[model samples]
Target: MIEENSLHPETLAITSGRPRNTPDGSINSTISLSSTFHAGGVVGYGRYGNETWTDLESAIAALEGGPTLAFSSGMAAISAVFSILPVGAVVTASNQGYSGVMTLLHTLQASGKIEVRSVDVSNSDEVLAVLPGTALLWLESPTNPTLAIADLPRLISAAKDAGCGVAVDNTFATPLGQKPLVMGADIVVHSVTKYLAGHSDVILGSVTTKDPALFSRLEDARKIGGAIPGPFEAWLALRGIRTFPIRFEKAQANALEIASRLSRHPKVDQVFYSGLASDKFHERASSFMAGFGAVLSFTLHSGVAEAEKVCESSKIITHATSLGGVESLWERRRKWSGESQLVSETLIRLSLGCENVEDLWSDIEQALGNA
Candidate 1:
């Protein structure tokens, strides 16, 4: 057997969890479509277990450097974690994190199931101040839409000292860009529907952990909640992971070029990509991440009308909501009802793809001309 730990992540991405040649000399693992296995077998039912899911989970775990559990969607994985918390347990989360996470946290808080404290994750002092009373510290570095970077080492250390568990939403910075587990986080979460799947054809979420007890608890929650991913989705995600490193590299390069150009564009007010030297999070992002990621957000000098026009004016770039696809995507985030009020109405979030840099630039230039 090959030693996966000795190999680079790029190598692991392709080789990990792959089966050796079968009796028929097949290289690819076929999707197990059976919903029920034979009686007295290790996997008696599809809902409980499947070979396709196992392969996908193993691949994710190898990249994340821990054991992993897959769910129907990113929100399902997040909800499973929250469900494991005791009633009224205090959880501190990023104020500018993903809107879906915030909405769920707010709903839970309203019902008095948990005590939620929203804090600026970028500010280590603010995060530490609330740590004493917090049962869990939720982190989202390079936060959604805004791209605010968090100081994970400092916050994770403080949370550990305070005896609080730390969970980082590693959706924005994929495992290839950043490893939260190596940074001392207790758990790392990913919305595999995004970058991990790369093509945006599948919806899946995963949680990885080094702690056996926590992994057991999360697995129990997943099994009981019955929010497992489909076998086909898992297979597609595994295929996507095989090329994640290469896809991420191209996307990052495209994003840096786009962000640089947007920063100097006359109609642009500000660009929020950590790859840019002028970005507030650039320094912190450089210290921790292997790459600055593929997503970037910028604000227009004009208001919502101009932003909407820019979104509509794009020729090559599609104006869409979800991101991390093979083709470039951009949208005015405020149009979403669940978007954070912190995100400005004029802010445009862009998800760079593997498309040619010059072509993407031309599309953006044309869009900004209308703005």
Candidate 2:
């Protein structure tokens, strides 16, 4: 049985989706570096498909509970979603959305195809206020940099009522923490480059949606967008996904501990992690999450210059711009170009990894002390 032979997601990282032993008895899934996979001649070419990438695609689609389409980067996934909008259409989105998303919207507007309106994603009424004219409602729960949370079901219902498609950026929560498609999302999108890829190596994106109609439209756009991910990138994402449950478990634990320590640290002005009781979303997080996620935001007591020092002084945490990796990272979100002013200039976002909590705590404590 699959249950007996398979490891739970944690153990599966070391087992599932592997190439079975050849008669010679090998255990690992060998990387098929070929640009072409022509087993039945039906796979014919690599551009439209490949055997290994197809296998990885099927696995992730199963995990997300919907039909899927993959892309080279998270932005490509998002662009594929944006491609379906007709000229003069309207789109409703979050105030806390990823910075690059704003850039895309600017491009769409300049092309004379759409109008973009952003609102506080948690405030369902505000999102609904402009939904009547919208072609899409973009929700980013536990949004980037700020970590703000959104109620998926309510937003989806509102969008549906208005005849608009709902796309939830599920990168932060990942499927293990939240299943947006099951909850009513028209489409569930990810920067698989982050949590799903887990290792910070693959730069990929995916969109999973239950509606066959929407899937078809997005699928056509994906093939032409020429945003397809490389075969190896898909393989890497597939490999990384096996460890999600464990990676998330350890990262969540480390995040909570680090949040608690920083909340009490004298050199810290405030922490923005939803897992903390002091955050507005703590109750919602408690009700919805298996646990709080690994990303946390904190501000240095002295302000922007001191915030930069926290990044410069940290010993154990890497001061970088990306998140959801096996190694911890720290960065000033406001300074990350294109991010909204809502991200406090003094705030430094931390992405907790599988590292020992004590070491993370020491590094953070010492870095704040430098301020």
Candidate 2 matches the true fold with a TM-score of 0.92
Considering every candidate listed, which one attains the maximal TM-score?
Answer: 1
User: Which regions of candidate 2 deviate over 4 angstroms?
Assistant: 1-30, 36-40
Residue 329, model 2: lDDT of 96
Residue-wise C-alpha lDDT for candidate 1, range 1-371, written one tens digit per residue = 86778888889888876767668765655588998888987768787888888888999999999999999999999999999999999999988789999999999999999999999899888888889889999999879989999998888988999999999999988888888999899999989999888897999999999999999999889878999999899999999999988998899899999999999999999999999999888898898888889999999889999999999999999999878878899999999898988889999999999999999999999988987
When superposed on Cα atoms, how far off is each prediction in RMSD? Answer: 1.1, 2.6
Q: Which ten residues in a row have the lowest lDDT in candidate 2?
A: 4-13
Q: Write one digit per residue (lDDT tens) for candidate 2, span 44-78.
A: 55666655666566656766777788888889989
339 in model 2: Cα distance from truth in Å? 0.9
Top candidate (lDDT): 1
